[model samples]
Target: MITYVYLVCKSLSLLFSSSALDTSIITYDQTHLKTPRFPLTDLELASLYENWLVGHGKTYNAAGEKERRFEIFKDNLRFIEEHNSVNRSYKVGLNRFADLTNEEYRSMFLSGTMKRVKLNRMPGRNNSNRYVVRVGETLPKRVDWRERGAVNSVKDQGQCGKSICVFMCLFVSFIFLLVEGINQIVTGNLVSLSEQELVDCDRSWNKGCNGGNVDYGFRFIINNGGIDTEKDYPYRGVDGTCDQNRRNRRVVSIDGYEDVPANDENSLKKAVANQPVSVAIESSGRDFQLYQSGVFTGSCGTSLDHAVVVVGYGSENGIDYWIVRNSWGPNWGEK
Candidate 1:
């Protein structure tokens, strides 16, 4: 026997406006009712639970804690199943982050270490030193550095507070590949830069593992000649010695970096069109933690806590969004 679940809540419309949850926008035929799968046996649930625990690297200090975490994991799995049953435009599923509470998820994956960038008004430009725009020029509809093979694969920060370093490394790597004329079709010779090198060595005004700023990282890159490749200085998720011998493995260098005017999306768009721009945004909200695929129309503030890279931007289903490259691994969102 098949069972169907219908979501008819009015609040759901407001909660997921981008999803077009309102019946007015979606006709009766457009609404999809998912058929329920066969219920798992107790033995099956136990096996799945063990696999999930191992897959997510979950652990407990005591028997009581383990029991509590197991219940939480089961609840999360049920939530995923129910959420998937709804007639939403996007899909949601269980991943490494499924079992975590909202706070735990934010602290582990979404926590950022970005420092506010002080912008200086240029004499002849529109506040920014690098980005210049004409009065009535047509901007591209979409610009993805990933499509052009300039951007690297999404990396996982893995509980380390080195988001700032990861953002800096990704932005610099994109710029380096762009300058080198490497494209999607010809990426065999492209090199991935090391974020661990910055984490270990660049300690002028930034703290390793704890937190840091991208502005200081950019300065370090310029002064230290260049950054080493990831193969030469692998990330250990902790701070270590800056290998003097491996300093010769520098693969990418940047003279400097410019920040777009604060809270100015237009200036940021221009910057991203040229290259992947290092950016910081509020990422500690529940909606952000639960974000699946689709344009993120969630309640994101302008606190600027976590650092990320804006690789591209475009409008989807009339909702405009910045294509942010996160450091929370590929399993967390649209990889």
Candidate 2:
């Protein structure tokens, strides 16, 4: 579910996802720009895989796992080679996820209660957006909250758990804390809020590590009188016993959250321009998994399975693009 809110300001209804332009917004559809490429020989593939293993410092704990991963690595290597070989708007490269098959990647990151629990259980499809642009509302040609010291540093949700919703929801809250300058985030003093607070404490309509909802997490923070700082509560990745003492050390809070009107790109920009907006997206496609850099003119699906923050939007080389703040650490995304 795509959720929106601000540090006591306006919020847009666009789902977790793009661009600066004339008042009228143009939604971009994914285009497949594949090029046939020669495959690497088995010997060459093995060599590259060995080099990748050394660079990434990877080792399999169990027998047969290394060999099993090797095949998947080769396929991903071919994909990266093919994508980089072509003249596409965006590019693909091997990342920390290079060794996992596309199915494994999606199931681990995109499945479970973190994403859509069931099609019928999806939230806010019929809800109205909170922010709407006037016919002649003026917007900046570009909006980057990072430059304004609103967005926090990139982070990685270790593979110990599947609480992506926890990371994304807290990330948005962190940004709002920054934007509101709550405790000096705007003065070059950044803070990492505790995602584990929501992961462990917020059990209403959410599971701890298996999966969770961003909206429900926010409500937990609000009712709890705000969340604890990461320094106090910290993230353990896995679900653990809730520490009420740490949970009571409230740090920041938001009044409420709203949904960005589904499929409304225009309203999304408005929300992002005012303040970073949390978005839900379908990040299960293979193309998205290997995305390296450049503007992502997506051919990805619309399953709304993953969440991220849209920090800003602008036009690049005449093509408008959104700057998404992903939680896969600094190694991933077009940051």
Candidate 3:
């Protein structure tokens, strides 16, 4: 009877425990229990990737402009933080911008505030009109709204007159921002090329105040991976890496000049392929040039002993600098 009573008590205890568990516990389906991966648009993903490499609180110059520190846009901050590798020791670098082309950037920019406008020549009686060229929806583009003036008829002007007028009024400020963005893209904010500095380089005989530095200023980055180099005149490298036309060939190490135009036909074009352009403070007699004869295009710099392409150029505080292109990934240099 005692044993039977003990068994009854144990059964009661067991029943009570089961009842308590059922009341306190909550059940979730597999679909509900699993955490869903956050979906980021391409822009968000790119920004996140850039932030992860550039740094959480880092700031960069917008081209070569001063008095401005471009902040890392916050389109996808939270999502980036989740995927950022905690084990990595280095930050994202600016080099990623070097290999990026204007077309590729345009795709990203299209997602942002890029705008297009039609322009024409003023009927100089000798020159004709040019078609529509998309302008970035930003200050600099608006500021220097008339840099390469392409005239339009009153009717063709459409409703953009008021907006165009506004941009024309703020040309200087917009130019400064444009240069700043270019500089940021080039040097990764490690260096800045200021407007004043560019002017100084243009005016001074020694360029960078005798430093032998010439500013290329900021330009719109263009993408060109799809084009066949050999088939194309300007872009003639095997992988469309560099221009081919003798006239369009980039002048590597303008042996004795500064601010040489990319399309300068007078400039000696390199006939050889894969020639690296070298940076020399004094135009050192080094064979390795920083810019390749037909390997790549765009502004770049290099040392006599070590030649590298000037993927980007900018100015800072009345000084100019170059953004060298490298094959390394984001963590390797400027992100």
Candidate 4:
């Protein structure tokens, strides 16, 4: 059965939203994530491609396009098989994104804000530079806000270039959680905020479906008085004009946001130990596209291209991982 996750609640307001992880579209054998691999013949390749298409419930509009996608799928299959044939910590498998070329994949899924970024002082941003961890303090071995019922749900950006499901999709959900977490810390109430509100109205810098800056989103919230609830605005996965009435129904609000020191894992851990933090990472590698499971300490690049949330952190048999709240939907990860 397939389940749809509408988390961009439309996609991103600052960062790129998930374009594939319907996480409705999950696959790869349980064995695939941690099992052995072997070579496949031409006949095997043809058969596998057919099965993948059927299983994913996919159809191309034209025969030529289908053929093109098949070739792309074949190339991706070779990469997955080659990587998995080796004994490695992580494995790759055929997911919904298999037919897409890397360039096509990045264009559709990765937000532009994550690329070619030039950092500057964000106007009206909170100026605090430190997370304030005491000298004697030590982080716990693991922290998972999902286990503690702090996370809301997984989201899928579909084909969104960004999320409220417009330009940058993941931030639509992450920022919602970030503020919700903070609100819970203060009011002890959990409310789902509307990502659509940001998508439609925050046009000063955000591009809706083209991508936008993540940092600018917080200030937009403060200046707008507050944000609306998801029920109030709802996600449409496409661009729409801002609704004047619903746009003003601010259900949740924040005082301001602070930035974490760059290249500082300790400070990051300290922050994650306390609450879910918005973050970006380089997710352009083909391996990242087909990742099945196991800690994703990857073969990806340093070029930041995607945005996600660090809800918590933990260590497992010496392997440490951040509990990332990706907008790829529930089916994509640890459901």
Cα lDDT listed for each candidate: 0.54, 0.59, 0.21, 0.64
Which residue pairs overlap in candidate 1's backbone?
A: none
RMSD of 3: 28.9
lDDT string for model 4 (225-292, tens) is 99988888987666679998998888888877777766667777788777878877667777767665
lDDT for model 4: 0.64
Clashes of 3: 48
For residue 64, model 3's alpha carbon misses the true position, in angstroms, by: 36
lDDT of 3 at 270: 24
Candidate 4 Cα misplacement greater than 4 A, ranges: 1-37, 41-43, 112-124, 159-166, 330-333
Sort by lDDT, top down from the best: 4, 2, 1, 3
lDDT of 3 by residue, 1-335 (tens): 00000000110100000001111111112211112235646665455444433442244456642112112222223322332223221111121222233343323211222121111231211211121122542211111111122111011111112322221112211223333333343444422222222222222222222212212221111111111111223211011122223223221111111222232211201200111122212111111111111111122222221112322222222322232322212222221
Q: Once model 3 is optimally superposed onto the true structure by TM-score, how far is the C-alpha of residue 163 displaced, in angstroms?
A: 17
* TM-scores of all predicted structures: 0.71, 0.76, 0.17, 0.81
Give candidate 1 regions above 4 Å deviation: 1-51, 54-61, 74-91, 112-132, 159-189
Model 2 poorest 10 in a row by lDDT: 20-29
Write the residue-wise lDDT of candidate 2 on 1-335 in tens digits: 11111110122221112121111111111221223235656775676667667756789999899999988987887777766666766656665578888888776555423443342334323245556778898878888776777666544554445445444443334443333433333345656787667777877756776555555665676677887788888767677798989988987765555666666678877877777767656577676776655666655445566666777777656666666666664334443
Clashes of each: 0, 7, 48, 33
Per-residue CA lDDT of model 1 for 101-161, tens digit only, reads 7667655554454444563442211344555556795678887666776655534555444
In order of TM-score, best first, we have 4, 2, 1, 3
